[model samples]
Structures are given as structure tokens and as C-alpha cells.
Target: MKRLMKTTIAFILMLMLTVLPACTMSDSAKDLNSSAKNEVGKSGESITLRLTLWGAPNEISVYKKVIANFEAKNPNVKVELQSIPTDYDTKLTTMVAGNDEPDVAMMESGSIALPLAEEGKFLNLQTFLEKDPDLSLDSLVPNITYSSEVGNIIGIAPGPESYALFYNEDAFKDAGLTAPPSKVSEAWTWEEFVEVAKQLTLDNKGRNAADPEFDPKNIKQYGVNIGTFWGAYSNFIYSNGGDFISADGKTFALNQPEAVEALQKLADLVNVHHVAPSPVQAKNIPATNVALQTRKVAMVVDGQWNSSSLADTNTNFNVGVLPVMKEPVSTVVCGMFSIFKSTEHPEESWELVKALIDPEGSIDMLTYGTWMPSLKTWYTEDELVSKWTDNLKSRPSGYKDAVIDVMLNNSHQTPTGYVKNFNKIMDVVTPALDKVWLGQQTAQEAMDAIADKAQAQVKGRRDLE
Candidate 1:
């Protein structure tokens, strides 16, 4: 049931996450950029670059501003913005089959971009990126950069967003517990987190899960809601020193002992400890902010984009580092900005890609809080971090240590970013994991049953392997 709810929410949030915020820095564009405009025609005919992206109307509206800015700087170029809000992947396929692919596209990493890049559909921007005076592949965060071949850059994530532990401060006070650790080194251990949960989880008769007379069936407020989705759960698998796929990308590894142990601990929270709500019970819970505000659950594991949603709630909520099993780990997930091989104006399209991804170009996006900067300097340099986080209501005080520090020092991009045929592999793996969430099978039993089928789809890791 958690999977079912998350599937629906993921579709909407994933779409929300994929929308790229356009640059509004018109006055300083020339001062900030050193690259010469690659004019389309020597004869002065206007070159129109077709740009395709998926987003809601609100997101699309901001993107149009970005396009307008690009056009302002390069007066000879015209950009036709094609916003596909629904059936994006299917429509992109239709465009490909019809030989009408857009000049540039914002691609969902695993589902659309990597598979197409392997088939030679997207342009290799390696040479362009290397020669660019303003930015290089090294300018971005290492985890968000990708290449199908060594030194052959294919696509780069336009922004970065990762998973973190969000909790209600008021709930913590009620339980007489301190807030979760803000720094990675101070993160709680698995046992410590469970013990805290037991104290917070309450029954109808005002008994905690730790109470001898506590009744699981009468649970009124759960201590936590652990996401069963891969994006949320995979952090734990990696923290336990395991992975869904091997680093070489040729093996299915979720059946390994380390992975099994991490997953079992999460299951134990639901079935054994009863500190977490069961799938059926969770169906009634609202969104993350509402749940925390209503005190339906004390803590939730979710993406950083929830920061904006959390700001609207009256609850005194804050974020903290996820507990460690062995390593302090979090998963970063984002779509890549890629130029299609079909583009007649690769130079101009590359310019558009660079403009959209530059953090300075999209500062409004960062301030509004659905996105994080894609560049490493944004995390490592205090000046850059302050540019986005300073006095920003959505960014709580602990954000620097809990979100920024962890992303820089202890983050891994989701397997979807690098693993081949990731969507296909998940199709075989998710159903088996569903049984684990349902309490119908142990993590080991469920994974063992499907490992063979999942392994058949393992081709090789595509990104920087």
C-alpha cells in the first residue's frame, strides 16, 4: 500500500522535480558569460532551436523566462518551447519515430536519457564542454556528471536534490527527546533510532510502543514512516555497504547479506517493533508536512523538495541526517539536460543547455526551494551556499550541516542515473520487494526469488564506469 501511494505521489513529484527553472539574470548575462554566441547562419537568417521539456504550467511559465533570456543574449537565435505536461516519454518516442526530435530535451536519467545515449541518440558534448571557457564537467558536482564513454560527456543534471530525514520538533519535545543530529559524524545508529521511535509511537490508550501493555492494533500516532520506494530505501542499502547493483553494473546485488540486513531492519520497524505504520494504516496519512503537523508520524524520509511544502505548515518541523547502519549515505536524484543528435544547431543548443543549468542563471529556482544548485562550488564554498540559503525561510538553520554537508561528503546518485535498463530491472525487482513491505516474505526470501530474472537485465553501468 505504501508502494501504491508512493507510485502516485512519485509520478506527480517526479514530474515536478524534472521541470528546469529558467534563468532570469538578464542584466548581468553578458558580464557573467564569456562564451561567444554561436550564430546560426552567416547570412543572418534566424535559427530556431526546438526545446522540449515536461512540467506543470507553473514550472513551464518559469522556463519560458529562461528561454526569453537566452534569446535576449543571442538575438539571432529563436527558441520554440514545447512543454509536454503529460505522457512525456511516450510523446518523445513518437517524436523520435516521426523524425521530429527536438533540438534539446530535459531527459529523465534512467527511463529516457541513458537508454537513448547508449543507442547514440543524444549528442556527445565532451569536446564542447572541454573547450568551453566558462564551465567544464569539473564545474559540476561529481555525482551529477555522466558519460557513456570515458571522457565522452553525454548529459549533466541541471540541479541536485537528495533524500533526508524530516521530523516534527514539537513531537520531539513531547517525547522529551533531543532533535536528530545535524552533522553526519553525529548521526544516530540504527539501534538508537529504533529506541527513539519506540518512545514516540503511541497507542489509543496513551501508551508508547515501548510500554509493556502497548497494543499494535490500537496505534494512534506512529513514530516514523519509512519510505518503501527505491529512492528513499536505497540510501539505507548503500549505508549498510550494499547496493542494488554492483559498481561494475554487471551484477544484481540486492540479495547480498548487507543489503538483506538493511532491509530487514526497516521491515522490523513495521512488523516487529510496530513503531512504523503498516501499509494499510499509512494509506490514511496525508502528505509529509500535513502528517508531521497533525502528528500522524513523528518523522518521515523524503526528498529535499518537501522543504517548500514544509514551510507552509504550522508545525515546527526541521530536517536532520539519516541514521547510519555503517556509512552516512543519502541518494541524489535529478534529470539530465541533453542535446539530441538530431539537432541541426548543436552549438546553439549547447549554449541553451549551459544557460539553463548555471546556478546563477536560475537563482530564483533555488530561492523558491524546489531545486538545489548542480555545481560543487555551491556546496563547498560558504559564499555560494549563503547565496541560496541565507535567510531563506524554506532552508532551516540545520540545512547547511544536514543537507549541504551530507550532499557534498556522503551522497550517491541513484542507480537510475547510471544503471542500464534500470526501469526494466525495477519492474522485476519492485514486486518482489512489495512482498517484503506486505510482511508476506522476508527481504532475503523475496530477493532470492527474483535475483535471476533481475540479473538478466543487467547490461553494464553507463555513467563514468
Candidate 2:
């Protein structure tokens, strides 16, 4: 009887041990969930922060590294990256309207930044910058910084970018030209540039620009490839003393005499001079492919990002960089990061921002040859300038000087203002401008119509404000 009683007690204890563990586990799980809910204010601590940006494959890889580094440093913060193929503005607009905006977004330097800032969606960074002494706003390039600042700095410039002319050296040599212009100050004037372009242009018969039988229709090569995008057009307009919009952002100035003259000059390249491809012809050929691979055009104005793309191509031709117009005027576009007011951990977010844009990190971007550092000090530093020369050995004689001149003296912002619908205005203007390029309407006729429509849209935006 004693043995049986002992066996029964042993069995009961074993059963209790097994059951007790499960009960304890259930309670522990409940406690964990409760703690997480409390910490995250009913949402949960595993909040997924989203960031939206657009870049090439390599840029995506670098961004992923940055995010991974940020995540490893921040164990509690989980970030989700979102990439848009194209039409970033549309994606951003849709997400913002749905109240499903990413925690951070990358935007361009033109009217996009200004309009978004006016919408009050972006958090003002001025307060944060003033409070944080470690983040030296002075370190940034003045022109780029100025462009990124919307009203009172809703964004911080992280990358500085400028446009330069890319020319095919072999093409110039074949045309028997001495050398391409090197300095922005010495950059070929419109008339002089046209002359060089004419000489470089070729037809199937090997007849040069001097040959009367040089076939415009059967031409095998174009003199220049002017990017037809709005940003590209802005350079021509600005150089010709035209403004896209008035200072108030309420009136459209694109239809002014200067603006019309600029558009006419671009049109003349195709219709009158017959040295460039028609709008229809240009549309058929991809801009990058035309400039880099086919070498169909002798010169093209593109940004630093093109270097990476061209380097990956099979083309053996060396590219020479040129400044904007002869007057040495160009626009600088930049990308920036902003911290939102709704962030649960402002301090941590700011730390991430600083890590991503610090001098060392900025130099990493510049080393890739895809971007220019926003920090002004990097321009002259032996380490930074060396990279430019090392990678672009065959750069045109005056290319470096022109880049320095633009960086130091002549860069300008695209005019951000209180009008919230500035991009919408661009949407309308680009298509109308395309009509002029297509020869459907004259430059003045197209600009006049577009100005009337844009002015009404701008007025509506003003009324909303």
C-alpha cells in the first residue's frame, strides 16, 4: 500500500509540472503583448517606417546599405523601403492624400519642394538645425542649400547636383575641330556653338556642313542633343533672361518675349538650322542611348548621374564635360532628408539623418562618381577632387574650371514659393511645351495659351492659401 501511494504522488507531480509550464507560458505571452501595446500606444512597438525614393540599380544598393546600417544601429526601429519606377510625384501625391505617406521621401529641387512645403505636410527642420550644433548647416553648398530650403527649411540638402555638357571627343576630332570649349565663361555662344555643331554634323555621303548637298533629312549625325525635359528647358529660358513664373508664383511669365525667343531658338535647331533631329525623331530615340551608346549626337547636357550609366555601357568613346550656356548660368538640383513632427523618436531619427549626411557619408556618395557632395569643403579637398580627375581623365580642357565656376559663382535655385499646385502647373506646361516642339503650334502661340491656363491654375492655388 505504501509503494502504490508513492507511485500515485509521483504521477501527479509529473502531470503538474507539464501543465504548469504551459500556463506560465500563456501568461508570459499575454504580458509581452500588453507591454508592447503599452509602449507603442495600442499600435505595437513593431512600427514599420516607410521611405520612398527613386534611383538606379547601384544607387538602390547604396541606399540598402545605408538602411541596413541604420537598422543595425537602431534595433527597435524597423524601416521599409519603397521605390517608384517613374512619376515619383504622382506616387507621393497619392500616398499623401490617402494618409499613407512614407516616413521620409526624396524630392527634386524645383517647384516640387516649394509646393510640398506650402502644403504643410513636411516638418520644418529649421528648429532642429538651430537646436543641434553638431549639424553644421554651413557645411552645405550655398546654392544647393538655398534650393532645398522651402520657406523655412522643411528639408535638408543631402546631395548636391549640377548639369554639364557631355561631348564625344572622337566626333570632335573626326570633324577636324581643334578642341571643345572648356570654361563656362568660354563656352561657345549660341551662334558659335551652332557653327561647331554644323561642322561636326555628317551625312551618309561624308559631306560636311560646308557641302551644299549635305542632306538634312538623310543626316547620319546630329550636332547637339538638347534634353527636351522641363528642367533642361529651364536653362535655355534662364540664360535668355526669361522666368518660368513671376516671383509671387501667381503669374505666368513663360509667355514673355524672352521666353518665346528661347523656345524659338530650340525650335530653330530643328526647323531652321536642320542640325538637330526633329521632335518626332528625338522622341523615337532614347536620350541616354543616343548620347552614350550610338554616339549619334556630338554633345548633350546631362547631370552627374549619367556618368555611372555611361560607364556601364559598351561604348568606347570618351565623353567631354561642358558648362551650360556661354553666360555661365545653370541650376542646381539637390536631394534632402526631413524629420517629421509625428515621429515617436525624434532624437533617434535625427541621429540617423546626421549619420547619412555627415561629411564622411557624403564623401562616400561622391566617391561613386554618381553624385557631388553637398558639403562645400569637399570640392577643393584633395581626396574629393582627385576622384573627379581619376575617373574622368579625358575630360575637356575647361570642364573642371567650368564646374568650379558654377559651383562657386553662378548656380541658382528654381524658385520655390507658397503656391501649393506648382507641380500641377508643370504637368500642364510640359505637354503644352511638347506641342511647340512637335510643330503643332508656334512658340508664341503655345506659350500664350499655356500662360493663360497656368495663370488660372496659379490663381486657384492662391485662393486656397
The candidate that achieves the highest TM-score relative to the unseen native structure: 1
Off by over 4 Å in 1: 1-45, 463-465
Residues 1-465 of candidate 2: C-alpha lDDT, one tens digit per residue: 447645755565556557677656456556554654465543334445677778777667777778788777666677788988698878777877787766777776444555566566666666667788776666667655432234366666666666666667677777888555656556667777777778877788877565788887777787777767765666777777876676565678778888788888887777767677777788655656356467677777666556556655655444333433435566666677665545655666676666666556545455555776666666667776665545553332444565555765666554332234557777778888877777778889988887777877664323121
RMSD of each: 13.4, 10.9
**Per-candidate TM-score against the hidden true structure:** 0.89, 0.78
For model 2, name the residue pairs that clash.
Answer: 182-398
Clash pairs, model 1 backbone = none
Q: For candidate 1, which ten residues in a row score worst on lDDT?
A: 31-40
Count of clashing residue pairs in every prediction: 0, 1
